[model samples]
Target chain A: MARAQWPLQHGRPIIEIVLTLAQGAQKVTRRLLADTGAGAMHDPFDIVLDEVDCLMCGGKPSKMVPLGGSYSGTHPIYVIPIGIPSLGFRDSLFAVGVAAPPAGFDGIACFRFLNRFTYGNFGNANEFALET
Target chain B: MATATSIQQLNRDLADKLVEEAKLDLPSWPLGKFVGIANGHVIVVSDDLDEIVSQLERAEPDPSRTFVVEPGRDYTKVCEIWRIS
Candidate 1:
């Protein structure tokens, strides 16, 4: 089981997270998931992946590239230029985008692969239940 | 030139603008983000305003990450765009 430690603030969850990548892991927080969800935010797919690595297989990914001039800030986001074998691997490569991130890692799950999973928000914790 | 009072005031103003204009369910806090405000409202990406606001509220000073949202500033549309690059 995987867990994340969050802060406890007046018995409310105060973090923003998203769960696009489906992984089976226990969530832990010092406070509560509610604190993370006081407003809209990205899912914590990386944190969840710490425990449950997505075991998906056999999919054709489109070739996408990032525009050199297109940038959000000074930070540089990287993505795979060519499609690679997704199956027989721990985590599959999906589409990448340059957008605002939530808390944990700045990687956003692509909607193409994300369509294969279900999501839930238990207070401040956001979960993605992927199709195995 | 910003005192605690000024921070408090800015926080309140941002909270009000976020609620009234953006139509987002934001919690009241002293944290701040680089919000892009055009006409009294914070500019934000269509699907990420909530995530940005929540992060602003919780993220603390960490040496691992460089970019950090300060407290009492507005982060409307002018935010870091994340995509598969």
Candidate 2:
């Protein structure tokens, strides 16, 4: 089984996953937040990103949809390869790029990604683990 | 299965190179903008999404293959709060 650990900060399980956005040979990697609850089937995307990250990754805007709260607006979606180096995981999924993301996160890793692994939060150890 | 494996392998290789290059080059890129990468090189950087798409259409027609980077944001902070109902 492959396992990875992450720290719990501010009552949130924060883990570093490498995100690779690519078309052909072009690719970029950045660390992102592993958010277990960020997934919403109603949203039309598997992951969420800051607007800049989505566009930089060459994601085309699909139409503005209401996301509720102050976050409502036009959001862009991109189909790209996302990788979690820690788990040796990689897959292509739809992602939403929003104008504003909450503090300290480049993007959120929702259930679409998290559902792939068996995870455990070891608060005592100040870490979380993911097993495939 | 074989095809999937090959694709996975290709993605891994591309990801490895990207991670390495990002560490070396992205530190100097201006923050709060979308940056596009293709052929292992930075192609365009802009704050306007339309501008990025236009440039990418000419540089990398297949957007899925082009990599985009969002520069300068802390990944450690708690961004979304979750509550199970």
Highest-lDDT candidate: 2
Q: Say which candidate scores most in DockQ.
A: 2
Clashes of 1: 50
Which stretches of candidate 1 lie above 4 Å from their native place? A1-91, A95-103, A121-128, B1-85
Please tell me which predicted candidate would have the highest TM-score against the true structure. 2
Residue B62's lDDT within candidate 2 is 54
Off by over 4 Å in 2: A21-31, A41-43, A60-64, A122-125, B1-85
TM-score of chain A of each: 0.26, 0.74
**Which tens-of-lDDT digit does each residue in A1-132 have in candidate 1?**
223223433332232232232123332211112211111232111111111111111111111222222233322211111111211113322222334333443323333333333322335443422322
lDDT minimum window of 10 residues, candidate 1 chain B = B60-69
Candidate 2 lDDT by residue in tens digits, A15-93: 5655444345455655456666774433345677776766565464332333543255445456455666767876555
lDDT by residue for model 1 over B1-85, one digit each (tens)?
4554454345446544544543343343333233322222233322333343333324421111111122232333232223223
